[model samples]
Target: MNSTAKNCAALAKRLTDSGLRPTPQREVVFKVILEKRDHPTADEIFARVKSQMPTISLATVYNCLETLVQCGLVRQVNLERAPTRYCPNLHEHAHFHDDATGQVHDINLPADTLKQLRSLLPPGFDASTVELAFRGSKGSARAKLAEGRAAARSGAN
Candidate 1:
């Protein structure tokens, strides 16, 4: 079978195993995540899915997303108090969050660094989960704005 078919089958199996009722709406959500690489937020996802599944409700999208997250098929990220974002990438990687544009990108860290960090932790502190996010504004616009703010603060001081 082709990659898309394989992904769909895998998602269906996962949902079934997780005791989630496999509905058409949920399947479409999974397909969107598998096809789109943007790592969309809930709103973004709802908009895209609605174009195809016109009858699908926003609440249904949210519920499907929550169910997918619970089934360990999707990762929900809340970067710096912004709206939560959903990612289909299951591997371990850091994230770069652009505060101005609200975009998130994945950054892979070295395995050795992860192991070393886990080793230095205190006893009884198991490092099963690792999430790192760098938040900043991208491009010259944000840079100029930040510089202006800094200048104003220094002048005030």
Candidate 2:
């Protein structure tokens, strides 16, 4: 099977395994989450899904999100004082939030770094999960262009 088909099958299996029925709404919601790895809020997801499935209701979307998160098919990224975002990345990683654009970027940590982080825990303290987040300004397209121009001028010196 192709990657898309494989992904769909995996999601369906997850729902089935989690004791949840993989309804059409749930499938579409899962697809939206996977298609846009931008970690969108529930409202953003509802808008996208509405385009595809105009009959879908916001309440239904919210319910679908809850079911997906409960099934481990999606992760809810809760930022302090911000709306929750849904993520489908099931790997161990950190998130960098661009305060300027309100975007979240996933950062894959090196195994060594993960090991060091775990080593910081006190003895006999078993930690199964870790959530690391960072906030900073992600340079804009205009800023990047200006930086490139500066580099070109400096190189010509």
How do the predictions measure up, each by TM-score? Answer: 0.50, 0.50
State each model's C-alpha RMSD to the native: 15.3, 17.5
Model 1 regions lying over 4 Å from their true place:
79-157
List clashing residue pairs in candidate 2.
Answer: none
How much lDDT does each candidate structure score?
A: 0.83, 0.88
lDDT (tens digit, per residue) of candidate 2 on 1-157? 9876787898889988887787889888988899979999999999999999999999999999989878777888873678888899987889999988889999998778988999999999988987789988887789999989998989955
Query: What is the alpha-carbon lDDT of model 1 when measured against the actual structure?
Result: 0.83
Best by lDDT: 2
Error of 1 at 33 (Å): 1.3
Candidate 1 per-residue lDDT over residues 5-94, each given as its tens digit: 887787789888987677889889887977788889888999999998999988999999988888888887762555678999887778
Q: What is the model-wide C-alpha lDDT for candidate 2?
A: 0.88
So what's the TM-score on candidate 1?
0.50
Consecutive 10-residue window with the lowest summed lDDT within model 2? 72-81
